[model samples]
Target: MFHQPNSEFAVVCRFQGLFPDDIGGYEKHRTRNGGDLGHVDASRSHLNRRVIGNADWAARTIAMIEDMKAENFADEIETLTRRRRKKQLKHRMVEGPRDPWRATRHGPMREVILTANRNWFDAPATSAARAARAQAFEDAARDWLLANFGEDVVHARADLDEQAFHIHAVIVPKVQVELNGTTRWMLQPSKHDLIKNYEAAQDSVGQHFAPLGLARGERRAAAVRKARQTGDEPPAYRQHVRTADWRKAEDTKIVETRAELEQRAEAMIVDEIVLAQREAGMIARENAIEVREQAAAGRERAAETKEQEADAMLAVGQGLAAGAFDIEDRDGTPALVETPEAKPGLLSKLRARMALSSSGRARALHVFSKALARLRKQSRDEAKTAVARDTAEIEAADEKIVEIASRLPDAERRSIGKIRLSLSARIMALTGRNMARETPERGGNDGRP
Candidate 1:
């Protein structure tokens, strides 16, 4: 029976570097249909007008980064410690010709286009049904982005104007992470991480759309493994040969016995299972290490935040005492005050005045201390919770590791035995066939081509 075409989901992930010179071109392509520049194709246009969420702010953002770097270079140099200055000089010397605009290897933005097999939408008879399918696909794409990248997803647009309906998303690489007991923003997720996330997103999209008759696309590795097990030419190889030619060639080759073929297939299956188990063990160890490191970092951040808050409160109290004063107005009402010349502005003056009175200062300090204390307590609590969660995760991973390790040896041995048996039987059959064929041609022991 002929089966219906499966709706397969795919995500094409590309990281285009927003160089200083290429920014204009990218911006043009994103904003307008290039007339003579040919940045965008107008011939196959389906869009009547600009769609929502199709703005080109990424180039502008990259330009802002460049401008900030240039403007702050002197300030950065002045603030750097002696050791830091030396390290910076060394890095600049070693890493030659760095692009000011491209901060990371994958640059500042990531573009992911999520599309599915065209047949999925084309098969719908009604325009409303087609629109529904398109909306479903876009929704799935948006969900994948939010789940994977969270706030890092800068912009996402569903472009029905394209030949195939797809969602185009731009993601900034910035992420807030705790490093050395401090929360800081950094450009995260290298190209490798992006690819990993993309692969995971593809799986999620498949799961999300599964009820709607969409399936995940087959992975290249899985396809290769299947081809190996089947002992047939893979799709890549089939591209070079016609089906009729391939069939005729296969007919001329000596076929293995059904029993031997079955044994070999079983051996391959067992081998694959054992390999998978080993991989699972390795992944478990890696996860355990990652979780432990995260827990350690969390504890450090909590401690650091507590220390920083204590220091800040102490400084505020010291500053208030050193700057305390009193001023009597024309009405002879004594009011706590700060020297107007000493303070920067009205806000600073008000703050200083509030800190001058013993009662007001004490109340303000108490409120400040309470807030900091609450923050510190929350940090500690979160750290503890993280530790507990990760601990459980690691323990479960360890159990899986142990279970897989225990079963792997026996599985490997059985697979090896089957493989040897299959090989020996195939060799014997080949020899017997050669002998039988030679017997008929043995009329003369003459050498022939």
Candidate 2:
């Protein structure tokens, strides 16, 4: 018999950046604290174990990584400190860049989460095979991480108390770079380059777990490519959804919408100005051409008096060449030489500018269309969610009502049924939906059906 692929037990590998100051906070969260942590089950907290290093060990490991071919950035650090102090003196809140040591967008320490589905780790207390499977998977994952990241994997831990069984490893991507004829250490995550090409990293993780019969999850790149081909937005994965992240995305969208409206208004004004300038240029060109013709006519009359008919005819011919011809003296004779087709006029220039603006508007329209489609999809999804929640709540309330009614005396139950019928009638009247009438068989043990 053919068995289905264990796609649900696919390997998950993700990398996140953390600043120097955030490392201690992560340690506190991963380790034990005395207070009641909402998500944690304190009874099973003892089961949580450190697979590798602790906070002190991680700090020391980072120091070692920094010491290897390290570059002195004391001046830069001092300057940053002075700036912070100055801001503090002014009572202004200072927001530091992601990487304070260098001009990088990501922090130095990388947080690597390695895990599979929750179902893979779940097992009964006496099920030796299932328990062994969980242990084996964790062992393989930890070994694979250490082998791949080597010394960069500073801290690794397993938190079994949470909803899932996963290993968290801190990787400090400190690579040696040859700068100015010297090998210097730099906090560069590109040395691993997992964040940029996470799909490939996921593939690698999946291959490592192949012996355990676990496949890889859906590749994000594939989904993105398919979406692009279809002119549709890629589906959002549940794992990537966080409340703060969602809010940030919403705020960004609002800002972008405002910016787009401003741009459209600016474009409209530009088009109006360009059109006015074009119209003015056309009128000016017409006037100039008319005057040139009048001047040519007057010159023709003078040529007739002086009997220079050839020059007169030539002047008329040149004037009709749409302002392209110019008269020049060639060997003591006046001859027409075509000037390089006359430079494009102000009208032509304005037309060209308007063409560019039209293209920009077209692009903006395309973006607006995409945003509209996304909003429509979001509205539909939210409506479905709301309906589901309402239905579940109503069903739960109905069950409670039936339980309460069953405990009541026969007289009281009959009275309650009358009240329920009146309430249902009122609700149906307001909603314009017909409410089903109760039959004798459907009614309780009372003569009120």
Screening candidate 2 with a backbone cut-off below 3 angstroms (N, C-alpha, C), the clashing residue pairs are: none
What is the C-alpha local distance difference test score of each model? Answer: 0.50, 0.58
Candidate 2: regions farther than 4 A off: 1-5, 34-36, 65-101, 123-127, 230-233, 237-239, 242-449
* Clash count, one per candidate: 0, 0
Candidate 2 local lDDT, 10-79, one digit each (tens)? 8777787787656666767776553225657678888877787654875686456433411222222233
**What TM-score against the true fold does each predicted structure earn?**
0.40, 0.44
The residue-by-residue lDDT of candidate 1 on 210-291, one tens digit each, is: 6666677556556777888999666662233432466556654633343355455777785776687579979989999998
> lDDT score, residue 254, model 2?
95
Model 1 segments beyond 4 Å from truth? 1-23, 35-56, 67-108, 176-186, 191-194, 225-449
